[model samples]
Target chain A: IPVLALGIGSPTWAVEAAHERGSLIVSLVGAPAHAESAIRAGADLLVAQGTDAGGHTGPIGTFSLVPQVVDVAAGRPVLAAGGVATGRHLAAALALGAEGVWMGTAFLASVDARPSGSVLDKLLAAGPGDTVVSRSDSGKTLRMLRSAWSDEWEAPEAPTPLSMPYQDILIGDLLGQILRHEVAPLVHEAAGQGVAHLTAQEPVAEIMGRLVREADQVLADLGTTRSASPASIRPAT
Target chain B: IPVLALGIGSPTWAVEAAHERGSLIVSLVGAPAHAESAIRAGADLLVAQGTDAGGHTGPIGTFSLVPQVVDVAAGRPVLAAGGVATGRHLAAALALGAEGVWMGTAFLASVDARPSGSVLDKLLAAGPGDTVVSRSDSGKTLRMLRSAWSDEWEAPEAPTPLSMPYQDILIGDLLGQILRHEVAPLVHEAAGQGVAHLTAQEPVAEIMGRLVREADQVLADLGTTRSASPASIRPAT
Candidate 1:
C-alpha cells in the first residue's frame, strides 16, 4: 500500500517508515515549494491540492497550482485536486499537465461515503457560492458548507480561533454535541466549490462510469473541434 | 462601445442605457446567481471573474465558476477570467465551457501595458505565493503583491478598511504621496495568481503568439494521445 502523507510539514519519519515496509510514499502539496519538500522527503507521487479543496487547504487554486507543481515534481506523477467534480474538470486537469485527479468532494455525496443525514442534506443543497473558507472549525483554514456554526464564529463578538490542536480540543465537545443532537442550523461539513455539481447521492460505480464516459467524450471532441483552434480562441489573448 | 456592467449589483439602469444607445451590454459575474441576474438585466455577453483575479474579485475560483456561470448565462457567450495567463489556461477555460478568456494580470507586465517602474518590478518578481488578497488598497478585496502597505493594514492595531468610494477618498492623499515618493517597500500592484508565469516584460504580441502556439499544440496532442483515454485516467475517480 502507498502511504499518503499530509503535505503541510516535513514527513521524514513517515517516509522512512513507508520505505521500511517497501511501500511507495504519496505526498500532498498546495504549492511548488511544498512539492520540493515532498520530493526531498522521498515522496514517490504528488497530489497538488488547491485552496478550492474542502478541508485544510492552501491558498493556491487548482488551475495554477498543478502546472507549477508538475514543473518541479522531477518527473514524478502529479495528481490535481480541489474543485474537481466533473468530466470537464478531469479534462482541464489533464490540460493543466496533471497525470490524474484526486477528487474528494465529488465522492463525499456518494452512497458509499455514508455521510451523516445533516451533512448529506447540506451537501445536496449547497452551490459554489454557499461555501466559505474559515478557521472557525479546525483552527486551520477549512472550506466548508456555510451554517449557523460558521455564522456564529464569524460574528464580531466571536474570539479568534486558536491554532491547530488547541482549537480542535476546545471545540471537540461542542462538535460532538451538535452532531449527536443533529442541530439543524449548526450542522455542516467540509465541501469544495464543486459542491454545486453534486445534487444527488449515487453509487460510487455509477459516478465513476459517468465521469469516465463524459471525460472521454469531452477529450475526443476537443481533439477534432474547430473551436479548439488558436484562430477561434484568438480573442482570448 | 459595449457597456461592461459590474455584476456585483443589479445593472438594469446600465442595460437600459446601453440599449438606448444601441450598444451591446457585457457583464462580469463571479457566481451563478450573478450570471442569472446579469442575463435578466439583458447582458449580451458574460465574463466570469473568479477569486484568483487581481482586483475586486468574488470568492469563486475560475475552474468552478466558469461552468456554473455558463449553465445560467442562457445563450450568451461566456468568457473566463482570473488565473488565466497561459495557453494551458486558455485550453482549460474552453474545457470548462467558456467561449474564450478575459485575462488581466498577464498583460500587466507586457511592454504594451507600460506598467510603472515600481509596479513592473514587483510584478516580474512575484510568484503565485507572493500575492495576498486584502481590503487595504481599495476597501474591496484585491489580490496584490504583498507589500508594507498590506502588512500595515493587517496589523492588529490597524482600523478596519471602510467600504468603497469612502475608503478611496480617505486614503487618496496618502496613496498619491506614496506613489510620488516611490516608496520602495510600500510599492505594490494588483496581480493574479498567474503572475508566476510572467517573469519578464515582453511585448504583448510575443505573449499572445506564444499562448496561441502552446494552446494549439496542447489541444492537437490531446486528440490523438493515449493519455486522454478513460482507462488511463481511471485513477482520477
Candidate 2:
C-alpha cells in the first residue's frame, strides 16, 4: 500500500506517479479541507485524524472530524484515526461513517513494536489527561506523553518553538542526549489519549483478538436495540 | 428531570435535597474525574460532555470521554454530548456506550428556539471551525461563534478573563449593549462544532424526524457490516 504524508506538502507529482504504478495512495487528514486536497491529489483512502491522535495531529476531535471527512470524501473510503484503541472505538468510528480505523498509539507498547523501556513505561503509566499537544518537540502540534521537559518548554520564559525542520534541528542534540542517557524526567514518547486504555504490554495478536471480541460483543448488544428511533431518544433537559 | 450545573458550586445539600424530592438527578461531566465527583455528589445520570460541546465544556473530546465515563459510571447510564447534531452522531454516541445524546448547538436555529436575529444569522453562517472555546465570555471556557469581540479578547494586550460571575459582571454591560444594538461583528451565540450542519431554521419536529430517519438508516447500514470481524478490519498503513 502506497501512503503519503499530505500534511507536510507531499508533491502531487508523487501521488500521480504512485497512481500511475496502480498504487492505492492513503493520505492522513486532520480536517475536511485536508481531505478535499487529498482527493484532488488522487488519494484513494483518507484517514480522518483528530486532536486525540498521537504524533502530529489537527485541532478537530475525531467524533467531529470523521463525519465531515466522510462527507467530503464523496465516494472514497475514509478511515477514522486518533483515540482509536478499543473495539468500542472501532464500532463508534463505523457509526460515524468511517470504513475502518487507522490506529498508531495502540501498537506503541505492543511486544513486536519493541519501544524502549522508558518510552514503554511512560506509555503504560499515562492516563487520558497525561498527554498534551505541544510544538516543543516538533514544530507542528504533536500529542505525546507529558514530562518535565514538556513542562519546561511550556513555561512562560521558554522561547517559542520554531516551525517544522528548523525546530527539529534546534532540539535534535538535546533530544538525542536525553534519550541516549535515558533521562527519566525529560524522556517522553508520542502517544494518544487512548493511552488510558493501554495498561499492559501484549503481543499484536492478543491486542487484535481483544479488539475483535469486544467490538463484536458491543455490536451485538447494540443490534438488539437497533429499533431505537426518534421517539425513543430521550431529551436530556 | 432534576438537572444540576455541577461545574459550578452546586452544593451537596442541593443534590441531597433534589434526591429527597424523588427526582432523578442528572449532571454533566467532561472527564472521568468529573464523573467520579458527580457520582459522589449523588448524580443518577451522567452526561459525558466533550470539548466540542457548546457553552462551557471540558478538555476531553466526546469520543474519548464517553467510554471512560461509562467505565467509571459502571451500571449508570451515560449520555454523550458535544458535536451531536446529526443522526450519525447519535448512532456513534450509542456505539461509544452512551445511552443517548445531550444536544445544545443543534437547536439554536430551530424556530422554537427564537434566538435573536443576529445570533441566528451568525449561527447559520458559521462553519465547524468558526466556533472556538475561550474564557473571555463568561470567565469560563465557552464554545461560541467566533467574532471580533472574541478576537479582541484574544489579543496579546488583552487582560485575562476573570473567573465565573466576576467575568460576567465585568462584561455584562458591554455584552448587553452589543446585543441591544445588534452589533454585527460583536454579536455571537454559544454553539458546537456541529453548527456546520445547522444550515437553516427548522421546527423541532422536523429536526427530530430527520434525526430518527437518518439514524435508523445509518444503524441499518452498519448492521449489515456488524459481522465485520478482526480479519475484515484491514490495516490502513
Candidate 3:
C-alpha cells in the first residue's frame, strides 16, 4: 500500500491510523510542535518545509527550519521540502543535513506536467522577483506568478482576501473562466521564482538528471561528500 | 570627473550640452528610438536597464534588453543594470555578453547602505516571492516588497499613483517620515527579493568577496575556463 503523508493533521490519530493499516506516517504542513508530536506518535520520517517553497509552506525558511527538524528527528531520516528547484539549491539543502530533497515546483514545468501553453510561457518568461506569497488567490500563502488578481488583492484600496473554503469558492469560478481563456486578461500564471531558471519544457527525467549532475559537481567542488552513492542521489529517499 | 549618463531627457539640447562638457551620454529612461539617438550623438556607453531592476528601470527585462544594447554598442562595452545581485547573477550577465554588471539593490543592504532598520528587517524576512512590480508606489514599475501601500494603490478601489515628479513630490514627505522612523509602519519597504539572501549585516567588501567567491566556484564548475582568472573578471566598468 502507498503510504501517503498528509500535513496539519492530528499526529496521535494519524499514527493510530498508520499502525492499523501497517503503513508509515509522514507529516506535511507541520510546525515544530507538530513535528515533535508526530515523532512521539511514531512517524517514520519528518519533512521540514520552508517558506521559499511553492504551494503550501510553513512559516520557517528551509535553511533555518531543515537543520532544526534534522536535530529534532534524532536518528530518523528527515526530508527537506520547499524550494528545492535548482541543482545549486539542492546542493545547499544537502549541505544542511537533509537526508533527501522533496521538490514540487521543479516538476511543474515538465512536459508531462500538463499546464497550459500560455501558463508555461509565462513561467519561462518570469524572473525571481515575479512571484508573490498571498492568501488572496488560493487562501493559502501560495507562491505564484504575480498577476492582476494578486495585484488587486495586494493593493490598499482592495478588500482583503476571504478566508479558506470561502476564498477558494469565490475565486473558483473565476479561475475556471481564466483556464478556459474566457478571462484571458485575468488568467495569471502561478509558479515559484525558480521559474526564472526553467528556460524550456523537457521531461522530468532529463530535468532530474541535469539537476543531479549540476548538484553533484557543486558538491564535489565544495568538498562535501554525500553518504549515498551517485546513482542513489536521484530520487533521494 | 564623475559621469552621469542621462538617457531619459527629452530635450535634445540637454544632451548636446552634457556632451559639450565631455559628459558621457548615458540614457536614463527612454525607448529604443532615444537610445539610437543617444548613440548617434556620440554617447560612450549604453546602460541598458530592465524592468526587473529596482529604482529607475525601463519596461524590458535585463535578459532581453542587455543583448540588444550590446548589439547597439557595437565594439563599445555595454554595462547591464537592474536586478543583478549575486555572483551567479553576474556570471549570467557576462554570459549575456555584458562587459560589466551595474548593481543597485545588491548594495542597498550593506552596512554602509542607508535603508532604515525596520525596512532592512522586513527585507531580510521577505522571500523571493514577497516582492512585486507596481507603479502604484512610485508611478513606475519598480520592484518592491509587497506592502499595504502598494496594495492600496493596486486595489480596484484605489486611485492611480500621480505621475513622475508629482508622485515623487507627493511621496517625498511620506518617504522622509519612513526614513526617520516616524511613519515606517505606513511606508512599504522597497527592496528586491535579493534581500532574503542576507542574514546579517556585513561590510560591502565582505559581501562582494563572498559573492565573487561563490560566483567563481559556480563558473569554475560550469567549465567556463575564461572566467577562471580573478583579474580578468573585474567588476563592471
Candidate RMSDs in order: 3.5, 3.2, 12.1
Q: How does the DockQ of candidate 1 come out? A: 0.42
Ranking by lDDT: 2, 1, 3
lDDT tens digits, residue span B22-95, model 1: 77666888888888888787777889988888777888888778888888876568889989888888888877
Residue range A87-121, candidate 3, lDDT tens digits: 65665555444566777777777888977876777
**Residue A8 accuracy (lDDT) in model 1:** 62
Tell me what TM-score chain B of candidate 1 gets against the true chain B.
Answer: 0.92
DockQ of 3: 0.04
| DockQ-based class of model 2 | acceptable
TM-score of every prediction relative to native: 0.93, 0.94, 0.51
Query: Is candidate 2 or 3 superior in lDDT?
Result: 2
Each model's lDDT comes to: 0.83, 0.84, 0.62
- Candidate maximizing DockQ: 2
User: Candidate 2: where are CA atoms >4 Å away?
Assistant: A2-10, A227-237, B1-10, B227-237
User: What DockQ, on C-alphas, does every prediction get?
Assistant: 0.42, 0.46, 0.04
Whole-structure CA lDDT of model 3 = 0.62
Model 2 chain B, TM?
A: 0.92
- On DockQ, who's better, 2 or 3? 2
Q: How far in Å is the alpha carbon of B7 misplaced in model 3?
A: 25
Per model, kept true contacts as a fraction are 0.46, 0.48, 0.00
Query: Clashing residue pairs, candidate 1?
Result: none
